[model samples]
Target: MSLSFHIGFNGQCKEAFEFYAEYLNGTIGTMLEFKDSPVAASVTPEWQHKIVHANIVIEQVELAGGDVNPEQYQKPQGFNILLGVKSESKVKSLFEKFAIGGEVVLPPQKTFFSPCYAIVVDRFGVPWKFSCGK
Candidate 1:
């Protein structure tokens, strides 16, 4: 079985999915909300901004996500979403796209191991690594 990556969005999953879909032409495969699921009874109105679950596919890769109850949205210590690109243009394009309202730890540039590499923490605090094929 192919395993997919999961992201926990405290309350901005829809926004992230929208941005990725728009920029990468990623398809939103399916969605299931907490209020629509059996857990609806347990979800509160305050969690309105958060998404219970959303599946967005970019170039066939599935990025799954949902909101963690605010009272339980724990911070992550480490881990990052790594992206492999085939060209310098792709690196620049993706770096700029995800860097909007986000922090860039390093600008896209050549690294000894790869043609280009960059690191960034998106507005949602999810760290990402971008690299162009050598």
Candidate 2:
């Protein structure tokens, strides 16, 4: 079985996914808003314009995300979306970009398993890990 991750956003699904697609050099295959979905009537008027679902392909991985009601939204914990990059320069660049307006859990550094490794919690509150398995 193939595994994928689905993130829950606090009314920032669209903006977050757009940023991800560009920064990760990924392709967005779907970006359905609540107003365009069948469950439009079930959400509040403000949520109608929010993203109901969005999916992006970063290489072979398909990442999905959606906007949830404020009351149902919670900060992400426990796991991080790890990206195995091939270039050390690329990893450093990504680490800097993600660290802007976000927390840098670990500055890019060489580790036993990878030449470059870093962790950052992005402005959208998503934690990411970057590594170059050289």
Candidate 3:
């Protein structure tokens, strides 16, 4: 079986996927909103516009996400999605862009691990690890 990750957000699922597309430069596979599902009428009015399922491809990696249902909501945890960059400037640029209004877990710096590495929890509370090969 092939396993895949599905990212979740409080309410910014759509926005986050869209933002990632910019950096990923990949196509959005599909999106199914609550309003388009067979159970659309069963959802709360406030959640009708929220995405129930969506998919995106970045660097050939398929990334999918959706809003969690209250009955089965599971907050995202553990593993951080990593982006391997090719240069220090790229790592620095991405860190700055996503770190706004978020916490910096590790400042971008040269280390034994690599020439440059940084970790940040983005505005959406999703953690990202950036690094480059020496």
Return the TM-score for each candidate structure.
0.90, 0.95, 0.89
Residue pairs in collision within model 2: none
State the lDDT at 7 in candidate 3: 84
Clashes of each: 0, 0, 0
Candidate 2 residues lying further than 4 Å off, grouped into runs, are none
Candidate 3, which segments miss by more than 4 Å at Cα? 70-75
Q: What is candidate 1's CA lDDT for residue 74?
A: 63
- TM-score, prediction 2: 0.95
Best by TM-score: 2
The digit string of per-residue lDDT tens for model 1 on 13-132 reads 788888878877889976677767777778787764457888988777888988888777865448888888789888899889889999999999899988999998878767888897
Q: What's the ranking of the predictions by lDDT, best on top?
A: 2, 3, 1
Model 1: residue 92 alpha-carbon error in angstroms: 1.1
Q: List the residue pairs that clash in candidate 1.
A: none
Q: What's the distance in Å from true for residue 13, model 3?
A: 0.9
Give Cα distance to truth, residue 113, candidate 3, Å: 1.5
